[model samples]
Target: MRPKIYLYGDSITEESFGDGGWGASLSHHFSRTVDVVLRGYSGYNTRWALKVAERIFPPVESGGVPPLAVTVFFGANDACLPDRYSAFQNVPLHEYKQNLHSIISFFKKRWPEIVILLITPPPIDEDARLRHPYIENPSGLPERTNEAAGAYAQACISVAKECGCPVVDLWIKMQECPDWKQAYLSDGLHLTQAGNRIVFEEVVKKLKEQGISVENLPVDLPLIANIDPQDPLKAFQDY
Candidate 1:
């Protein structure tokens, strides 16, 4: 059976299978070698994800192939300002950190050999958020801010180090580009194709560091190139 790679997070992850999305890129990158499973919930926070973690990834004893790796990508919603329209999604920073610790612990308990890759929330563009408000904002303020997202990103990285897991510090990586607000983010929060590409590259690079590269993983079945046209059934005989 092909080893699986799980993507667990909120809206960013929910949209990760869309055209030019990072998740789709990973699927293509590891084609036939692994299954990239997504467990994403739009508009969810760590608190909510923690609540549903077991449901999404039940104990391996429950009868499913355990994943080789899991990417935890969340925090955008959790950084929303308490006074904003999206305040309902906001989780206090300390609690957010705790939730991440718990989430990682849950996965470790369920799959002791699992490789966890933590992804920090990408930086936001307040100007773009104002232009693309989720609702008409009478206050004319963006529900989220780059500073808040940075804080969350830091918290995420801290958690990864504490838990001894690999991490993709996306917020810092994206900002390394001079025009990241326009090049990487679509609506200040969601990612553009360029942004997705950055994520794809970073994820592949990080996974490679953990010795989970495509070159290291075996293809699930015989290569079609090796099949004889006259005896195609030979491939299936052993399959």
Candidate 2:
């Protein structure tokens, strides 16, 4: 019997329209036809996900067939948000790390048998990092948001290690081949179609590593790649 798998993340995992999102793309890769539930939200932190899980996942009932897996990808927003002047507030790395630990513990306690996978957020562009007003802060902390990107990834791995769970390092992969203006939207956040495809491929590989078969999937970049959002496409091509 196929096991039920749940994916938890932010915007990158919420591509509802098609296979662009790893959540949707991975659904097609399972060899034994596993059930997948995409539990994704936008602008969420690990602390929020931990609280929300109690409300999102159904309660345990004997013979109800617990989910086989639950993967988590948070911390993008936890890097801190922009202030009134559009300056990055800069979340403390210690607090960010603690939030990760809390989420891991919450899920582990709830589903001890389920395989937990911790995913680190991808990298931030240097240009985007420099643009933030707080980047000019004299304290020298806000400027480290770019550096915190690495800190956040390491924190994910640290939490996973403490909990004995596997982790997927999306940070290095994205850095290896960042598409610059194309990979991210104007906000300097969120994944473009090409970017999401890369993440989906990694998720598939990780699933297989977890002993779940996710092979022979037809992966495609979203239409966001073909037609530039700036210029409108012809009637036949627009859809």
Question: Model 2 segments beyond 4 Å from truth?
Answer: 16-19, 81-91, 126-145, 178-187, 214-239
Residues 130-191, candidate 2: write the lDDT tens digits.
45432344442333244557778888888888888888887777777646444643234557
TM-score, each model?
A: 0.95, 0.73
True-structure lDDT of candidate 1? 0.93
| lDDT of candidate 1 over 10-119, digit per residue (tens) | 98998999999999999999998999998889999999999999888866655667889999998999999888989999999999999999999999998899999999
Question: Taking the candidates one at a time, how many backbone clashes does each contain?
Answer: 0, 0
TM-score of 1: 0.95
* Number of clashing residue pairs, candidate 2: 0
> Candidate 1: worst 10 consecutive residues by lDDT?
57-66
Tell me the deviation in Å of residue 140 in model 2: 17
> After aligning candidate 2 to the native by TM-score, how far in Å is the CA of 215 from where it should be?
7.3
RMSD of each: 1.5, 11.0
Taken over the whole model, the C-alpha lDDT of each candidate is: 0.93, 0.66
